[model samples]
Target: MVSFGIWGLIPPVLTITLAFITKDVMVSLFLGILSGTLIVAGGNPIIAILNLTDMLAGSLNDGWNIRIFLFCALLGGLVGMLSKTGSARAFGRWAADKLNSPKTSLLMAWFCGLVIFIDDYFNSLAVGTVMRPITDKNNVPRAQLAYILDSTAAPVCILVPISSWVITVMSIVKGSEGFSSLGISEFEFFMRSVPFNIYAILTLIMVLTLILTGRNFGPMAKSIKYAKETGKLYNEDYGPAPGEIEVEGEQNSSKARPMDMLFPILVLIASAVILFPMTTYLGAIDGESITSLGAAMGSMSLGDAFNNTDASMALFYAVIFTLLITYIYYTVRKLFTIKSASDAIGDGIKSMVPALIILTMAWTIGSVIKSSPEDGGLGLAAYLSEVVVGGGFPIALIPVIAFALSALISFSTGTSWGTFAIMIPIVMPIVVGLAQAKGLMDGAMLNSVLISISAVLGGSVFGDHASPISDTTILSSTGAGCPHLEHVATQMPYAITCAVCAFIGFLIGGIFLNLFVAWLAALGAFVLALVFLPRIYKA
Candidate 1:
């Protein structure tokens, strides 16, 4: 193993710093990969370039990565079909009647986000598209819409039980030596850890608090004021794309009904929920003859059943099924001709190309960090864990430290999945080592483990929400037709406010080992912050 010692941190740090400075995610990621590869190649430029290519190729070739990429493309196509059918517009009109005020409109967007808890990417794009027209009509700023879309995307997914986020987390935790040796199932751990995910829970709560209080602060407040006073939804620097306006106008011209949009989404959700459990049960009974479905389900806990299920495969099947159903529904309703529907599908996939590219690069950088030293990978997790352990860092402070590190990493990288991939493996081992050293498992030590895991997830979401380079952040801006930098600026204060509360929650939870008490304190802190901070913006 070619250990880089503490030097392994330089690449990611450089990548993050440059991203903020240049405001170019692609270049930031590329240069970060190059820096890491150069260090691995002993400063040889040619080998470093070759290594970067190999790293990206390996990431693309991985089965899980390929599945997620395909899912994104297919989901995009489905959304495209929704747009082509005028379903989005119909839904917006229907929603406008029910949600008359700006506050209610924002809440409806947040509620839609909560309802579509399957995937964050889907959540960001779909909610933004459907809610943008309504919010704009209600005089809500595009930046505010972007903020609502972003806050609900990953934060909601991470908190929910049956989402892509949970599946990925369970899969990673299952593979960790700590959980495996302890005979603790990843699903069980995930369920137990949800409550301790203070950042995510608090973020969600903060969204509602802002909406209910009819409060907008920081840059968001100024943007909303401009929209209200001038009737311009976007800032001077940014407006809706030509394509977006054209689509909106086309949707207005079409005769599609609200069910046109609502039915397809309902079908998609039902199919996923039904198929996921059924497939999980089937996988659990592989090579065994279970005479009845009920018997098979009874044999395993829901967690175990889901644990054994191929989540990627389940989502793939669900998307394919949903697409077929959507096509049939539209054809039956005479909403569009076959040619138009097909064109929409193709266009939708094209729109997702940028997101897919960014995801691929994010995965590549994560792979580069985690790859073995023999493969010229930095093995960053192992190195960081070593540094933390050896540097006299206290074990009791792991949750808070992990929160800060994960936030920084995710903010820099703009990908929470990448942060989770790099952090979980590193943090679990450290937790195990600390637990063993303390000769504790069931009490405070176990709580620490749970809190630390939650901290990583919570912090990653917080960072992703705040970062301009994040895919969800970009998509949110696109969805709301807001300038990217404006979305980033307006949302940062809100995100930071929640994150501060979460940090305190983690600190209290770690010190006192009382999840309930810590959560209450954190919630109170958030409420107090919300009440006081808006007054500053008001002045």
Candidate 2:
């Protein structure tokens, strides 16, 4: 990879700065991409303009990107159908009677978030779509809902050993030549690293504590207080929220029931979980013996199926089918006319237009950062890797170094998977080289390797969990009907809190090589935050 020296840092930095300052992500992303292209084009203005359009177009050309775009839009359409039919309102009433309080409502949303942990995209969209009305009835702010959805999505998925995140992570580690020499299976290594993933574990704890204790702090607290005083779920001061454009028909029907809102969503969740694994399983299965679904199921364990699953493709298929089911389900129940249902679906797709545009620009900039150096791309990940690893840090500080660099790279590129691709290769060599050079083949060495690898994974998630340009971050706000910037702003304090604790944990782990002790120390700081933050920064 070609190096751009310090110049590679310009695009994401410019984009992030502009976003906070201007409160306009589209303009920020466009200018960010344009800056990178200009640098890549070596000051040729005309060439940079041409390159810009090409890269933007090129982002959608990738199959996974297009699939995810479609899935989000279709999911929006499904949510629209629920809203149009009065099912959402009915469900809200039902929930308000049962849940009764803000704590219960938020906890239910958090629980729903944890349940749909197959993919972060699915988790955020599905949980937000289903739980927003419930939370709204309890007067819980949309910003709070978005924060829960965002906190749960990536953190839960990354921590789960069977999630889509696991597939990407395991593939990276399995491909490392040094890993094979360690004589442990990829799954075994992943399981060992799980305890060391302090950020994901601790963030979930923060969410739970916040929900239970009503510990609102920073911008999130202000949003909560504003909602309580004004009776407005959304604060208009920020600007128009995306995912609020869906057309609605006033439901005059008395037949609307909670199941009207729920059955279709249930099918969607069930179908995604069942369909994705089968799709992944059947696609990867080989030989005549695995000719049928039963045969395939018999062939591999459930974990194997998930490991092979393609979350984007499966979600797109699941949403298309779920849309069909919901359309028919709503019409037959007399909640909507055929024409009304069709219009709702169309309007739902319309609602997602802003999110799509932001996603497009985000992907384009990511491409500009990832593209070959010769092709006017910065090779930003490669550049960052070279610059960071070239410094000779001590072995005892490896976990801290791994975490900080991984977070930086992931935040810069807005992709944890991209960070893993860059960092894992660099990180693996360090641990493996140490093992071989010292000829140490003991549990201490194994614990060191596991903690270092876990640090990289945890650090990567820190960026994905909070970065403004991250796709999951964008989707969380869209899903919850909160303005995107509000989601980013409110989430920053909590994300930073967890990230700091995670860094401290890794520093302890690196020095002592004890995962349990390091985690406890991190937990101790987190406990202090829980006790003091609400008192210090009251809503």
Best by TM-score: 1
Candidate 1: tens digits of C-alpha lDDT, residues 227-340: 878998878665343235334327433587877767877887788777766877776555566656777899887766755566666777888999999899888888888888
TM-score, candidate number 1: 0.81
After superposition on all C-alphas, the RMSD of every candidate to the true structure, in Å, is 4.2, 6.8
TM-score of every model? 0.81, 0.66
Computed on alpha carbons, the lDDT of every model, listed in order, comes to 0.76, 0.76
Clash count, predicted structure 2: 0
True-structure RMSD for candidate 1: 4.2
Which pairs of residues collide in candidate 2?
none
Off by over 4 Å in 2: 4-6, 99-204, 210-249, 285-299, 374-376, 393-503, 506-518, 531-539
